[model samples]
Target: MRQNHHDGTKRWARWEGASLPTNVRPPILADGRHSSGLAGCKGGGHGDPKAAFAKAPTFSPDTDFRARVAAEKFHLCRTTREKGRMGPSKSSNTAPSTLQVHRTSDLRRLLADRPTWGRLACGVPFRDPRWLAPWWDSFSESAEAYALVASDERCVIRGVLPLYRRSNHGYRDLNFVGDGAACSDYVSIACRPQDSTAVAQAMAAYLMDVRDDPDHGWDGVEIDGIAESDETMRSFAQALLVGGAAVHAHSRQSTWLSARRATWEDHLRSMAKTTRRKVRRFGEQIDGAGGLTKRVAETENQVDAFLDELIDLHQRRWRAEGVAGSYHDSRMVTFIHSVAQAFFLSQRLYLPTLWKGDRMVSAELHMIGDDRRLYCYSSGYDIDSSHLQPGRVLLSDTLRELYRRDWTGIDFLRGDEIYKRRMAATPQRIVCLRVFSPSAAGRIRFETWSAGFNAKQWLRRRLGIPPLSVVGMCETGTPSR
Candidate 1:
């Protein structure tokens, strides 16, 4: 349980009583996505995303809420500056007062506060000590991990973002903790809603200031999975540019399903006639064939069995497509297994298996988030059963059940594949950004990565091939544009 730090517990500065422009607004994407890395609405929106897809949704933040958040941060920053701790320029005129960055491990005492802890937990799932503890612990011997922990003037925890530095082919490049493995999609900073911009700017400035003599000097840092539509991503980009750093951004569209309808039939009505008909036909056919059974993992034994089957089936199917599945990496499998225990015990995990009499045909791993979003993390279906359309059938059944349970929405994690569009899932644009130190080594490393990345895009465009995606790892969060 987290406390509400926005309840005016801290004292306000005299500037708050002055005639300063109190016009800061929260950054909510016009497309209805909350730029703060959390969904703005609980479910179904009334705003017509065109008359064709009319659905009620959680509305955007009101002006009052945004004004309050903005005003609070502005006043606080001004107050800090007035004390002569930090000047308007990077050349600090006096010693800094409140803000300090710390390693992830040292944040326990700061996080002891209810409000701060809750904010971080909501930003990133703060459960599973095993998962959180090993966040910076990359299995690769070449990688070293740490998180930049930011605190404010009053010693209140503001934000934390994880980082991992490693020498990639003699080039020291700093990437995010889960970058090498694409398990995390929205790598947002764990900051209070009001302090996101400030914290991000501070982090960027700190990175620039200490690049020459960093704790561990790295050529470049890659911030991956930022939503292109998000203001926070833009803020970081702007901050880096202001500090005279080189930045490159690559973008992709991800899929998400809006589960705001009251019933399965109502949701189906919103889909194209062709898609709806196919789903109906597949459902009947699958049901008729050996009496299809949709079962969710319940007992501990069931969870273990289902996860193993999921990995096996997913691997087999992807192998047939000439790609090793996410489970191909022993480390990834181990990580998922390690986290599965906690998720299972809490019943937040949904491991669904589709069966035809005695044989399993499809398996999917899903995690329900605190914001009521259901993440369609990973799925695997028997390739031999493709003619049965087992994948679609499984997905359809899953959505129906999720709707019945009143889940807000379903995120397809990553990739805007044909099936997702066919299901009427909304497309959100997310980008992978790399920020480089203004050094010779940084330029060299950045160019190499950019060239390779461009070459892949060229090949895909010329060959009309599907975009390369994270093999089997995909996750849910609000930061994606």
Candidate 2:
């Protein structure tokens, strides 16, 4: 029997010593191993289901209970509201009365109602069955993840929002992970492209209603990774803020690299002089030194090798420093491989590798989203090739191709690297906001070191001193231009 703990809730499978529930499906563990403190699946996930993407399979939970649990959890989740908690709104109790979980069939109908849903609903290479299966259990319970259908008097499904509940500090919190930092790109709240505005309004209203529920169990929501160009997202954010959710903070959480200009040279001119010089020098050395060539993976089989090289490069880079890059695990590698395939087929995955003959010396895994080339991850020769600068060579070549392809800008997302600044890239700040009721349990303990009590914390950010909290939200920084 498996047992799990979430938000002060404990879940245990029914077991009569040696006997197990006849109906309980075995948990699908990602690997035979489980983390000491974290809940894990029964066994590791099996195989890469690339072919699964073609049909956009409907992901269902193992049982009816799992489904319901996921839905309930989502309803209890909060939306990213203002930075502070105020008195409950008079209409708090007037929000949506009952939350419903949309089934696969319902999801299909809603997608039919709004076709652009296809863009998001369509499975990508990176998407895995296991990544989504928890929602079944989550929605079934009043826990972490859930989904709801927006409807009218005729019971027509107008839209849907998938949400997750998380507690940070002393307060309960909710957010669209689609809008959180974990997602490489903004999570899409799908609607018919034509009803973008209406959908946004409906979502805002639903979130507001959810917020007003006393049992909502969250103080506020913190959606930190919304794209700058999403009008519907902007509308929803604005509505939430004006609806009394104050905009205590905002920042650019991620950057993008798009093909915009007529030529790569024009793109270079848009960067700093030092950056241009470095790229030119790197290119000259790579081209003049050996039969070095840069190539992108285009076939399914080629992707496996390309991904292998990516993982190897990342591990090699970090292992020396006693660190593990994000993709160090097999499951994570599998996840990236899945996403990369979908992105590649959509002309969205960019893997630029420098081949020194038959071996890859450096490589990068980038994503093509909307109109931008997302520089998601990279690994390459940094020391021995300091003179050769294989990484820079690969990056410049990639940028030139991106320019020729007419992408908007190269997004060097979230890192404060000297190379990024030298490229004339402007810093875009990503901010997370938290809120709490005045007297929630553990509230005082959570805020014992809050800015109100620690004036030095605020002064540190202004004086360019690092803030003291491990949580990124505690620091205050200026917004990017």
Candidate 3:
């Protein structure tokens, strides 16, 4: 049975002791080990019938009982609104009317109604279940998925903050789930534009209490990939300060673009004069050849085939530089394959390749968001074709294609590569934030990490030394650029 800790802290009490109800694909505990903490999946999941990308079959749960609980939760939210605790225009600065916890699988149902959530949705790659579920299941042994849904008084979900808890370097790290692998971006505490700050503050207070609970024993909460301009991170940091907690913030970057220009020509004209000239010259060259062909993956088989070509070319390009590329890791390969398959099913996957006759020259992997923005996640081009500027030409083609479709923006995802700047409007400042409660262990953990971080910026990058973090040695510890 679930129990309530009727304190003033205002968090949902306990997750019932029994197995998680429905919609959540609860993890099968290896060696009969079950988590006793309430800050984890009690469970929440979406259905996955295709095992092509996933290593294991989906775990189905009992639906009738779970459905009843969900109904009650909605009723609770509605009841709060009726009592004037919330209003359509502005809500009281107090916590949201209701806070319900969900597992990873619930993301599918929540995001399906994009009319409401779409305005502040997580990136497309993170929202879809087919992609998220398989990538999530890959880390099931080490990761515990939890989503905090903040609802207005009228039972309308105002915000959803989904995170994962895992042990990293012997510390219990509660952070974004896909941070270590695929560089998930634009992860904000989702809410109506006006309510974003309030919801962020609300979650901050709740998370602090959860960490301070003697039984919880959480070492730290690291939130990575928040844009510098974001108000939610500010609200969260301020809230933690008010609660006498410590917050450490670090900055990374993601390349950004404003494709909302009137026309493709106008967008190109906005770039640096040299870049504009270069792109036009290469574009003309490629077009003049007349044999240039562009292909989009229209089927699952095509997505897979193009993905292989991407990996092959990507690795070859990096190997030529005497470095192992991102795809060298078998785990990253599996995760990418799984996500591509899932996105293909939803028709949101874009694998566009440039070919000359039977030879492929450049390729890119993209996801079009529910909001119609495109994110260029990864790409590759034949290294031998550097004289032809394969990367620039491919990107030029992509931007023009989006322009033709009337799309307004494209996020180049996480990277500070020189090419990203040559094409991007300006780089957005993203941060890695770690908030720790007033505990000795938490303090030690923060200070130690801080010292190491300082050392890296001061020594590693400055000393012309390549650290494991930069080389992708599985130490994807923070917001990577």
Query: What is candidate 3's lDDT per residue for 151-186, written digit by digit as tens?
Result: 433334567776767777777777765666566666
lDDT of each: 0.55, 0.44, 0.57
Best by lDDT: 3
**Candidate ordering by lDDT (highest first):** 3, 1, 2
TM-score quality measure for candidate 3: 0.71
For candidate 2, the per-residue lDDT at 51 reads 20
Which parts of model 2 have CA positions greater than 4 angstroms off?
1-115, 119-143, 148-160, 166-172, 178-198, 212-217, 227-234, 241-259, 285-288, 370-379, 382-384, 433-456, 459-481
Q: With candidate 1 superimposed using the best TM-score fit, by how many Å does residue 271's alpha carbon deviate from the native?
A: 1.2
lDDT of 1 by residue, 310-403 (tens): 8888888877878766778777777677666667786678888888778788988877777767777788888887776777888877767766
Error of 1 at 66 (Å): 35
Candidate 2 lDDT, tens digit per residue, 87-172? 11123232221111121212222223323233443231111122233223223233355344333222334445555566565456
Better of 2 and 3 by lDDT: 3
Using Cα atoms with residue i matched to residue i, what is each candidate's TM-score against the true structure?
A: 0.71, 0.60, 0.71
The TM-score that candidate 1 achieves is: 0.71
